[model samples]
Target: MTSTSDLWTIRPAQARDTDILADIYLRVRRTTFLWVDPGKFHSEDFVGQTPGERVFVCEDRNGTIAGFMTLWEPDDFIHMLYILPEFQGRGAGKALLAALPEWPNRRYRLKCLVKNTRAIAFYRSLGFAIIGDGSSPEGDYKDMQLSGN
Candidate 1:
């Protein structure tokens, strides 16, 4: 991705950002992890209790929640990275992608639903290469492992 300030600021999520963070939880949750084993993702309780794992809202000039990304360092996997549908392709996600390294791994890993072709391509463009494929806990979902700098 390229560098551009565009329309947002990056910051740690605070307790006050609780509502917005919850929104992220609701918007994300099973939808993205439907292809990962249940054990790899955080438990529902962490949504409100784990502040360190979260990044707050990236608002546009008008102040809307463009989206946010959260990290779970133990496994080198980005727990969640989401941009509201309206905010997609406007640098929000890319900016968040660029920010991932701040969490510490130069080579990070994340799994994506194999059926989400759009996400697969987006991750590929960001230099994520495939490392593996498997089924989720349900044994019904197709998943792909992605790794990149």
Candidate 2:
């Protein structure tokens, strides 16, 4: 497996990927939630949450999981979009989002902790617009939506 930025592949996650996905989830969360208590970062709940969502993983040409995105398709909401810190800014996140099934005239939404400026900028770069604000266990969050064309 030899993947350049453009050569990475996206595919539906498999049962075998649960552990890696959970690890990625936790790692990314911990990095993004630095403002929160470190103890609050380790949770097994993410593994349970994976079964109910539509998860897609991006794999490097070497077959390594570089990132993943989980969406609650029926609700038109993206639950998470996490790329390994090393993989960030390399186009993996955009590739994952672009692979989502297109829905004509239907918008997709997600929330990012207001403190996660990097994520906010990344989402904004991808056309997601800030629509509102709210609070979460981690802290203040901003609701963002991407309009369906």
Candidate 3:
């Protein structure tokens, strides 16, 4: 599905977008996950995480990519959502989430690292609630779910 707003255009990711997407993924993870070893993140990690997932890219009015989100549709799981630091509060992330094909009508799930308070707050503001908690190699994370209203 594709969606456009004054600030962002969200569309299905294309093969040509992979490189920039990977770069954003690597950079965002390294900076956002301060508790993790930044050295362990690589562009290849984006490739590995995205296979079999439905991916979408968010671009600005200038056509510059601001972020991307990957969804495991079968489970309504939002596997990843990362906006560049510069684009974080400009509604790119919200646009990407709304672009989901089943958005607002189906439940969605995602895990946010507990220490990533900023992200957790963002999710919470969108009606997500912690359903569980677990530890991953990166750190402890909260399993959050946003149910259809």
Identify the leading candidate in terms of lDDT: 3
Which residue pairs in candidate 3 collide? none
- Put down candidate 2 lDDT per residue, 100-121, tens digits, no spaces: 7773245789999999999999
lDDT of 3 by residue, 98-120 (tens): 89876777789999999999999
- Which candidate, 1 or 2, would have the higher lDDT against the true structure? 2
**TM-scores vs. true structure, each candidate:** 0.70, 0.90, 0.97
Worst 10 residues of 3 by lDDT: 98-107
Q: lDDT, candidate 3, residue 8? A: 95
Candidate 1 weakest lDDT stretch, 10 residues = 140-149
As a TM-score, model 3 comes out at 0.97
What ordering of candidates by lDDT runs from best to worst?
Answer: 3, 2, 1
In candidate 2, stretches whose alpha carbon ends up further than 4 angstroms from where it belongs are: 1-5, 103-106
Per residue, candidate 1 scores C-alpha lDDT tens digits across 1-149 of 12225677665666776667666655554465556454554445347545456454566767666777776777666656777666778888777766655532376777666666677788787767777777654343233334422
- Cα-based lDDT for every prediction: 0.62, 0.84, 0.93
Q: Model 1 residue 34 lDDT?
A: 58
